[model samples]
Target: MKQMTRRKWLRGMFAGGGVTLLAACGGQPSGETTEEAPAADDTAADAPGVVEETGSAVTVTYWGSFSGDLGEAEQAMVDAFNESQDEVVLNYEFQGSYEETAQTFAAALRADTIPDVVLLSDVWWFNFYLANAITALDDLAADAGINFADYQPVLLNEGVRQDTHYWIPFARSTPLFYYNKDIWSTAGLPDRAPETWEEFMEWTPQLIDGDRLAFAHPNSASYVAWLFQGVVWQFGGQYSTPEFGMTMLNENTVRAGQFYGDTTNTMEWAMLSADLNQDFIGGSVASMMASTGGLAGIQESAQFEVGVGFLPQEANFG
Candidate 1:
């Protein structure tokens, strides 16, 4: 597409209200396609400039997953886009977590009732693609003047399937190791992150006492499985092969599982937490593996010094 500053294109995306679907249905033949023109944002009907400048501005309905501080930030972005110009206004609606958003979207597909834009997590996008419910973004992106070259390859490439772009990266994140620096100092451990899981194990006894955890594990809904993916990779294992072959029964996978099992059920230094971030902030746990997306919020909320490090290595770093 045309060369433009990233800032301008980002403004262009939300200004149209549907970065993912606003310039949609590219490559798909016209006539009888499932895609539809974006409906206008009603909340902007009473806003100034919209009626005076353009009669009716383009409105892109968006569904997303974010609440509390994150949600407020998301709203700020939407508001900024709406106020940036009178040509378009983003109508963002919170649909709970990524999984919940996907679930509602699945239902919308069946009912033929859908939003113009959606925030799809990496894993959820593929499901919609497989169902033939989403369109390739190549043509639409071109029409929208998006510069694929500007995006990080690792971030941009994840959306490719059959040589076409079906998803785009926006809010991407990965697991980060968050530790309580006060706890670490009091335990007399080194200030830096542990070099390896073995080393962390050696230090765990020093951190834990009287039901306090050296580390805490999140529950499944908090994305325990996603967090565990890092550990699996650190142990030099994978959940599956590229072609979707199961690898959970493999030796390295088994070893990873065993190590996790031992942490909670055998070693007694870590335990599964109801809320990993809360537990860590409340001083119930010394460390945890949580999304980098949460780091800012954690830092704002925690009473103690919060330190982040690379996830301690196992057989290899994830």
Candidate 2:
């Protein structure tokens, strides 16, 4: 494996139409492999700059979980790649949600029919690495002229383990505090996001309307833990050491938990929602914490003026 930049890696992965498949086959060859070429159509021959060669174009399957507008965007990218080159043809497959994609990949591993490429979640990619199910892209990236230094340190560091790079950040995001500015103004509260958990709590009472919740907590298994990490951090607690050797179980953790529990169970200020974005957009909740990746869609669908801010901090910890 050799050093490369993240920008070039992304270009090679998408625009350049180059991806090496390393299936999870024990003791089997794990390198670049291509699939049989599909029959070319009139569109292929008509594509600009594409010359019909004697040999069939190399094909590779890519599994991803994007749907809706994101799915459409991904398809457009595949189409552009296929039209740009006559040497390679990309086969795009929609494999459902991230969890479902993992399940399908696991089954494919057992059947020895894994896709050539996959889009994995940040939380789940490490498990695949531990299972020896993915490949190190360092050499391949270097060959593609990737400049690793161009990538943000925190995002690039997520894929490294014991000095080996097994994954690359895609669709990376941080939790953002999203709120309805109209609701805030109507409640006689400041027309801005609260800077701390205490300030947010103080605003909760005014934010509530009849049956509407001041805040909505995500209850889905995939999101609950991710959002809780921010709360735990704000309370001055570490989830676990990077080495995965030890985790803290102190007052900070307890305090964070109690604060959340009180929001719904005692203060009645918040309620759990399976879809926080929808709830906020529908005016059922005043504010909530969600991934920044959803901001575009939320803004497009929302009827009210939407406001975004950094996640509220704890008094001393932040």
Candidate 3:
């Protein structure tokens, strides 16, 4: 087995609000291999456009895909870091959406002009490892004396592949059950979110307004699979084995699919929507399962008081 490297690079970048790339380091873990060439040494010391000596501060570039208030927060962090230290200068850039950032990074990799630090999505970072587009941080972690065990086990494990850690949980999030408190009150339902699918189904009638949906199913390909995973687990089924090399097509999975179909197709309580959050905020939907990252935005946008809760589970499973 190949030894995995601790995600020290992530720790350093996150702490400093900047990142540095070490291109000469490369290693293959498990069955994967890559022949990618090293990126040119373009650190602040050698980069042409930057001043080599800014009061002896080391400049680092960070690329991210944050916008709106989130973008402002990131800029604020950069400002704080710059103000606190004279040894490091952090330059932050908003690189559009995650997909666009990935595309730009791929192009940069081919040209050997990649940014010192770039944000990669949870689903996409594994591909970067396969391509050897990034470096391991075992040595760096040891040099910095980072304690990997201090991080949350679940969140930290997401970064570990075959033992190697390639990504860290930054801006990590999960689906939340967001409900309109005013709508719930009008419906005469309980003040809290439903605890089970059956309970939610029971409350649907009261939640409905003439043409409004009680809930909206996420329709985008990106969200459907993620949300569906919760359903599959709730039904006591595994979508795939732990290794993800084989899929399971058992009765539980079938039942889970049937439940989703019933909600959207048969019962008419919920409809598939490309914009569930918008509908929920606009009063077209009484409730939705959405990213917790949007909680603040939803609170600011909604006219009614918002209530958040965990995703409802199957009664039997709960």
Candidate 4:
């Protein structure tokens, strides 16, 4: 395996966190006791994560895709890490959305001005991996004495390719059905989310009023694909095989697409939205599907009670 050097220790720290990285540095046996130390030398000075070698802390530039409430929280983590130790100083820069961040990263790669660490979404990391633009973390993590078994297998495995780990899961989440409880009560419907999209749509008419829509559809540019993937599966279809054989034209997939089109075009229940989050939080849209990670921001911003539940099912549940 290729060694992860130059940026190895820092990468390991980023993959893991500051606390875990530093803790792993003390590899003394459980029963071992401290002994009198010898005088410091060049080898001791050259050790990983030591500032004495360069007479100052190493500064690492990190590019991330987050803003607003999530952005504030991201900065908090960086501040905590910076304050936690003096060996490494994290310099964070907020890039825009995932798409924008990926675009900027591509440009940076071409210009050779990339930051020391760039946060890549799961969907974006594979492209970079195929282009050989990023390094493998297994070696760096191993050198740091990280225990892979300590991580949740499902999440830990997402970054593994051909048995080699690359992109670690950070802020990972899934789409959830979010609704305005106030609207539900006003509509005279059940207090909880419907068991199925069809069931939900049955009462959608009650939700559609003057300026209030029963639901909203984000455009393709706003990550509708991620949400739609679950919808496609719920309709008893698969977008593609594991090996990448697309099945968009498959009967079930087409049915799922038609269902979406009818909501905005035929049924006229849901309208296309530029900012669905704002719409839902502002009470203009009664319901929408969004990431679970949005829970905190929504709770903080919305004045009304927000109810969440599993996405409605259809021919099958995803």
Question: Candidate 2 at residue 11, lDDT?
Answer: 35
Candidate 1 positional error at 211, Å = 1.2
The TM-score obtained by model 4 is 0.77
Model 2 misplaced stretches (Cα beyond 4 Å) = 1-56, 246-251, 315-318
- List runs of model 4 lying over 4 Å from the truth: 1-53
* lDDT score, candidate 1: 0.69
Best by TM-score: 1
Q: What is the lDDT of residue 59 in candidate 2?
A: 55
- TM-score rank order: 1, 2, 3, 4
Task: Report lDDT per candidate.
Answer: 0.69, 0.67, 0.65, 0.68
Error of 3 at 152 (Å): 1.7
Estimate, for each residue in 255-311, the C-alpha lDDT of model 3 and write its tens digit: 888989999889999988767678889889899887777788889999999999988
TM-score per candidate, in order?
0.80, 0.79, 0.78, 0.77
Q: After the best TM-score superposition of candidate 1, give how far the Cα of residue 113 lies from its true spot, in angstroms.
A: 0.7
**Worst lDDT 10-window in candidate 1:** 24-33
lDDT of 2 by residue, 1-318 (tens): 122232234334433332233221011111212221222232211112111233555455778777778789889988877786665666789987666666787666655666657886665554555456565677656767765676677777767777766666665677888999999889888777799988888888899889998999887553666777778888987666665554557678778888889999999999998767778899999999888778898999999899998888894433
Per-residue CA lDDT of model 1 for 189-250, tens digit only, reads 98988879999999998899787889999775566777788899999999987445789998
Model 1 TM-score (2 dp): 0.80
